[model samples]
Target chain A: MNAYPSKLVERAVEQLSTLPGIGRKTALRLALHLLSRPKLDTHTFAHALTEMRDGIIYCRQCHNISDTELCSICASPSRDTSTICVVQHVGDVLAIENTGQYRGVYHVLGGVISPIDGIGPEELLIDELIERVRSGTVKEVILALGTTMEGDTTNFFLYRRLQDFSIKVSVIARGIAIGDEIEYTDEVTLGRSILTRTDFDQSIRF
Target chain B: MNAYPSKLVERAVEQLSTLPGIGRKTALRLALHLLSRPKLDTHTFAHALTEMRDGIIYCRQCHNISDTELCSICASPSRDTSTICVVQHVGDVLAIENTGQYRGVYHVLGGVISPIDGIGPEELLIDELIERVRSGTVKEVILALGTTMEGDTTNFFLYRRLQDFSIKVSVIARGIAIGDEIEYTDEVTLGRSILTRTDFDQSIRF
Candidate 1:
């Protein structure tokens, strides 16, 4: 390991390396880059991080990150309140929002059920989701989660919880992507795409 | 672009994207990671960057990042102040020091002479280096710089300036690396390695 010439640089690198996916070398590079930049840039970077940590709040209804009690999607009057899309992380909510295909609000479950990691349904917002469904206004619940075992476990748990209610429950469809070639597509996805194939005219705009 | 559920997240992502090598997607990921961590972690990260930028001082003699008036290498009595190694940046100084090979002090030139980048000799610390040489205590000045065209230009410029003095001006040697095979070496480097080969007995100890 290389010893830094400056103690300040060493400290900066140490702190930066704590971030996920960043290692010692990248931390050193980031530290050096910050040193090369102006004081205002450093101040802005620090100020943004601190402000985000101290000020940002989670939505009371869906549990997504928000500036107010309700996230923008949850608070928007035009969004359908009857349909809720349950996802694993706040980033997923942003991803769905970016797609612009879903018009319903989101429920961020924080993470999928991972027993090996000691995470259970109680660790997530599963109970809050149950409460949201019990309110009787929700007509449909969409499971928008990863295809991992943990995601499947969480989805099944949520299914059991909401099965008592008289509402529709659906999981997002799985298929080969639009631009993917069938020859190169994975066998499971190709088989599932064939099994779930819609009518010829329904699959395309005539 | 995805619309962040929170304005704070949007602002945080915007600030993080300004960092070198970080794109909007990576910035968003970083911001979300910060949000997932404790407030203390965020505080520590922010404090380190701001403090490093605000507190780090440049060595008066070597122009390297330092906590004191002189860098640790320049301040140490054991290091040979008479023989100075000149390099491009503080990072280079750290890199050379890590090797534990050199016993001399350093003079950082900040950057190479790049006319395309609008960085000339005046933009660098060339004049300060000459002043140090003129002090008459320097016996040798090693030009430890990169092998690029800009590095060569700067090396030539520095040599011309130091030729009037009685001090020895030399460049660091370039050759195939220790673990590298001669067959894989580039033609220019292979030919130069042959040209600069030392006596067989002197090159290796028995």
Candidate 2:
């Protein structure tokens, strides 16, 4: 054990070290810094974590994080109810919303099915998503997931489950990112881009 | 404002981002991770910070962080009272104590005098240090501070103040670090090592 003069400080450092990327040395620095500040700073910090954890709720409609029964995006009248974007987490929903290009709402799957991690379809909100689709309101289900094996596995699983419905299912485009030099592009992505080329008539915009 | 799905999450991120080295993106990740865990985890983390901040105190003798009036080092009977090591923070005390080579007690100055940061000698525990020296128990005061400009300035100021006393004042030796290559050592450190080389008769120990 490092020579922490106070037991309180040792406990604080222990708890802080559990956070991602924070080691014992950095935990000590943060603990000492918090100790040096006014009491109100730590008070607010503590309250924020505690209150947010205790008071927060998951959205009933799409399973995104929410403070109410429905998230703001799901509750918005302008959002397209006909298309539901499928994602692995609430963060993905926020990322798509930030682009402002997708006017459709989203359905958070909580996580992808991974047999190694013991996560099955039952563990995710797949049933609720099926229930939503079975209501006969949605026209399209977009698979905006990573190209990793687990993501593809989940996408295929969802595609099979939603096969009974007469809805369109599409995966997000896989290509070299904008502004990426052609010489630096990976072989697999560049090959796929060439094999599945799309129309070049799309308007050029930032 | 980044699109945090919930106001509670946004508030948590805002508070978490205030810590050193934690930016908005890392803060969001942390907030989401905390939310994903059981409520007890965040409760413990929050309680640790609040309890430590509210209950911690500075030792009366050494001014190191303490839960009691006197720090453990100051209260220990086996420690030497004749020599006192002056440090800038509690972390430095831990660093010196880890070596297990020094048995002397420590005096934490809180910080060094840095005119650029508006930190004066009065803002530190210099007066308390002088009072400790005046008690006539200490015979030597070791300056175990960084080699920064502010550290040098503080050392000179302390030297001037202790000029009236009949005590030995010394600084920790500066040399190339262990495992460092001689060729890669900076010019200033190499020059100082050459100027102040010690006797080789001492046994080389791991």
Candidate 3:
């Protein structure tokens, strides 16, 4: 039989190895590290993980994670409520926020449409988003999902749903990213960059 | 102010990032992955970590992790208790066990002697080990610690202490590993391999 110093240590390693990107060796190291620390520190770590999982609430309006009913972005009066930036996950929301380029609230779809994964439109917050747009307060819906096939499928689906609302629907621009060398850029991105080249004045503003 | 969608998420990410090799980005991904799983899975994970920390016991004889007063190795009657393999941590014991090369028991020092880290002989299980050797049943003590300065210091200290007990002391062999080519091998290891070259028959047995 395989030997572990203790069943408790083995159980902790097993649980930690279940995390993404962590293997058994890494899990053993992390488990030992936790064991070496002050007992109070490990207690705090466990408490934080459990409490975050159990108590975190999703924003009612936009389905973003929030401590309260409305997320900070949705609660702020300064953000443009008329424009909603649509994203696939909370991480994307943070990435967009880091850019400091947009001052609009966001609607998180939880995930994009992936039929192979059995994730359909009904599994997402599409109905809530449609209702928000129908309320007449929203004037524009910006699609900022990924560029994968699933992302494209989700964008097309959302566009079809919002067609009769008389609200403007737009997609985030995609091409060679800023500071990327043109020679090293992927063929599809370089072709799209030329086909959808922005005016000189607009490019200079960015 | 630094922005996080929720204070709970920020706290979880902070706690997770405290683990070795887990950066903020990876911690955030892990936290989100846990949140996406069933609430029961996360609860189980947290419970395992906390329970392991608060309830795990250390074997009185060898200071290895244990569910009882004596670790399984220490309690077993079939194992060769007369030959103790001393290591720096519980993980080291597991690693050696996985090799299936040794049948002797283990003594975990918890850490090596390092003046830079303020860890001295008193901080480790050196005194307990000396007492174990003084019991006279132990015939040999193998030092299986790392090759670092701290490991050497600790090994020297233990060797000096065991001198008075009449127990045979040995260290695990150190040289270029079997799979490593001489061209890519480091200078110190190559020199050591030549200086401590084993007899052909002895090497063939391994």
Candidate 4:
């Protein structure tokens, strides 16, 4: 009268349900759809998933996804090393890169500081960034992180840490809404907006 | 400027996009979410996808998904062998299986006969089913395929073919709306609804 769906279907259902917005019914539907596919297609799909897990490594320099020791931006000699853009995540790095205007390198903080989530300065890559700045290779630090409360907290922490440094610290400007996801924005507007960003402290001249 | 997203991200994105409703944005969001997760969690997630794809195979007897040559229903000697339920896809099998009443085996036709899509009887596994029936191991065939135009067309074709056999032929109730997906219906309604199915004849069935 009762049995769990086969172990494979159960596993597949559980995994698919973990994705954002997918429910048990949707997961079952998706699993059934996938099962109908030819074995090779499913195998290839699985292989891709497995390879994705094994292949991507976080860049040692900026924390962006990379195949090698550094991400593309960190490896590129043509990029402006004097200007480093700090962002909340690798996705943010991609969002800024999609503009094709920012020739400077980047630093991904892994995530914003959120007390609610128990994330703080020690949990982020702020110490590595401070060391990078202190190494005398950077002139400007573009704070392109989100404008959320957590983003503000991370930004303030960096501001205090870099108080004695000679680098110019600026945040990306306000064409973006406070609660919006940056990845969905158009490249041109975001580029124009980033280019026109104001300094964090107006009293301190560069 | 034209470089693809890293191979790992691209692979995950491609696989995710192949799902029914996922798009590139959603795929990327999911990929980044998985990327940000701990290594073991990501590995387990990826492994589940791959294992489901590779380990699961169609049951030779019922065409339902299974890890073995025959599905659980087909292997169970306790189930009725005289009545074989025919469905358009495996998902229909799950929908029917959700109802505890049906104790018969199943036959999956892969898809309906869609003239517009150039799908015909030869394209489906109908011939194999005819052979299975002719072997005298079956007495009745209940058509659980949907009520779409293609489904009707396929049913008509199958009905004509099965007319030669002495076995009784019936259809699941037309209580389902034409073009309605069976997966959306609840178990109790679907179960009680199937008990009252009208006999099919092109002229008087509707």
Candidate 5:
């Protein structure tokens, strides 16, 4: 006779082992622990997972999770409509939002302009961003991009396009080290960067 | 701003941080990694967790995950219905299932008798197991309980009660360490325990 009796448990462990950094032993342990939970708890956990899959939808306007066409920030009347924070991805928007100090809306670039990875400005949402800038409602463009080669290239590309517009172009503060992530940074440091941001010189445009 | 922008990602991290051994930074990292995965993957992961929480119902006959009155093991035609392997918990049932060698059904005691934890025989499924024995279909009862003090007490109690029934009662091999779990024991050692099981000499029924 074997030590365990359920093939279901073994199958569940095999599935979990496929996840990043999880091994077979760890997966088995986790699966057993999961099976130990109350049936109601498991049901609620599964329901939440299903809801996360089915309920979450990208905001058409700002590419954030939203029920409607636009995100809550885009629909808000209190936010400054004249300014927008252009970020590398959807996660950056949350990092900024956590501060609760920004009054402007956001635009997700989908990704940065990486030449080596074959990611070009044409591949990103830069054209749509230019369209937003040309709409005349936005008077300021905040470059909330990350500190990477792609971030710098995207910033340069956007700067060249926005040179014709008489709006202000600014970058988030540079206390964040090269290759460091803003998401993991403490609130105080991230908040400090927001307060002491530098203006992008118009001469560097193009 | 961070590279990612999902607020739900941030909220999820915050919630995850509340779990044991999970800190805020680790939570954020795990959340971001999860967010990076395809929506379907996240849904599946959540579904697994939820299924662990709710979908599993203990079999009425053998106290394992089952859709009907009896567990798969108990309902199987090829299994030895006369011999039942007794375990401390449903998890132990799973541990035994992993070996794929056992041809008998299982009886889960829910937990061992623990005076410190205030758990007694009435709190477990011992009475129900005794009733199953009294029915006379069972010829042998294998005690696969843990080696803890509570487990020993529970095993002794079962041995005493089952002594009235006209059947042989055996205890699984004692090579398993006093504190070690049967679940974590190597498959080879576990197999040996099942093969070289000893008769419960304390029983008068033998």
Candidate 6:
């Protein structure tokens, strides 16, 4: 690697490269871009990140990121308190919210159970979810996690834990996407779609 | 766009997405990734950017980013001060440095002369470069700008400005890259390589 002319530039690049997808070249580009802009703009950008990191809170009820004790969905009276969508991360909560179809609040697990990665139920918010369900307020728990091995393990684990509770548990449907061609769909997904096909009316409603 | 659950999250995504290649989706990803890590890590990252923006200086001699009045390269006596490589940005200086080929100091022009972008000689460090050359310390000025129209325009403009000074003005060579096949080479580059074929001895040295 070429030594950066300025230590400040070097530090900025190093810090930025730590982000999930950003590499050294991209980090350098981002640093230089911030340098090229007005000082106030960069200050604002930095301030936003700092504020988010230091001030943002997780909802007490759902573990979703929020500016208050409860996330917007959990705080709002219109949202269904009886139903909860359990997800692996805050990003998944955001993704489900973007759909605008689900009226329920979310429970962010923080991470799924991954044996190789050493992540287990204890590392996630699984205990909090069980407590919330045991309160007798929640009637349904939607498993919105991915189809990966880790996600499946977490789902089964959660299912076993919630079995004693009176609440109904459901997994998000998995199949070919709405507009995806049948020929392009994977064999396993296609086979599963055929076996667990929903009613045409229900599918059209979605 | 779906409204982010938290105002802080929304603001961070807005600020991050303003970067050159980052879109809203990527910005959200980055923001969530930062939130996933320890608060100290994000603070350090934000501090680095803020410090770089507010504390970084431009070299008095070459206009390169620096912590002091003079950049490290410009201050180092071991570097060839008599020969100056002119580039449009600090990234170029880093790129050249990575090659470990160029031993001379650099003159960062800040940007190329671009009429469409309203970037001209006045916006660049051309005046400082001219003053440096007029001091009679430089022997050669290497135009290491890009192969774009703006690059060529800036090169010609610099050449005209340096005509009065008793110094050799040259451009970095352009040709098919080493290990690149002729069949895959662009027509203009192939034509240029043929037109500006170098001596066998010099070519072998490179």
Best by TM-score: 3
Evaluate model 4: give its lDDT. Answer: 0.81
What does DockQ come to for candidate 6? 0.80
Q: Candidate 1: lDDT of B38?
A: 95
What are the lDDT scores of the predictions, listed in order?
0.91, 0.91, 0.92, 0.81, 0.73, 0.92
- Model 5: per-residue Cα lDDT over A83-117, one tens digit each: 98999876677778877779998888888988888
TM-score of chain B of 4: 0.79
- Which 10 residues in a row give candidate 5 chain B its minimum summed lDDT? B1-10
| CA RMSD, predictions in order | 2.3, 2.1, 1.7, 7.5, 9.4, 1.9
Give the least accurate 10-residue stretch of model 2 chain A, judged by summed lDDT. Answer: A197-206
Task: Please give each candidate's TM-score.
Answer: 0.92, 0.93, 0.96, 0.77, 0.60, 0.94
At residue B57, give the lDDT of candidate 4: 78
Winner on DockQ (5 vs 6)? 6
Please, what are the lDDT tens digits per residue for candidate 2 over residues A123-189? 9999999999999899999998878899999999999999999999988888888899989999999
Q: Each predicted complex: what DockQ?
A: 0.78, 0.74, 0.71, 0.37, 0.19, 0.80
True contacts kept of 6: 0.90
Give one digit per residue, the lDDT tens place, for model 4 in A1-206.
13434788888788878877889788888887777777777777766766777788878888778877777778888999899999988778778888787999889898889989999899999999998999888999999888777888888889999888987998776576557678988786588668877676962663
User: Candidate 6 — which residues are off by over 4 angstroms?
Assistant: A200-206
Instruction: Give residue B202's lDDT in candidate 4 (0 to 100).
Output: 55
Which scores greater on TM-score, model 2 or model 4? 2
Docking tier of model 3: it is: medium
Q: Over the stretch B90-138, how does candidate 1's per-residue lDDT look in tens digits?
A: 7788789888989999999999999999999999999999999998799
Worst 10 residues of 5 chain A by lDDT: A1-10
Top candidate on DockQ is 6
| Candidate 4 positional error at B174, Å | 3.3
Model 5 complex DockQ against the native: 0.19
Ranking by lDDT: 6, 3, 2, 1, 4, 5
Tens-place lDDT per residue, model 6, A36-58, is 99999998999999999999999
Q: Flag regions of model 5 displaced more than 4 Å.
A: A1-57, A76-83, A100-103, A113-123, A137-140, A145-160, A163-206, B1-60, B67-70, B75-83, B99-104, B114-119, B135-140, B146-152, B165-206
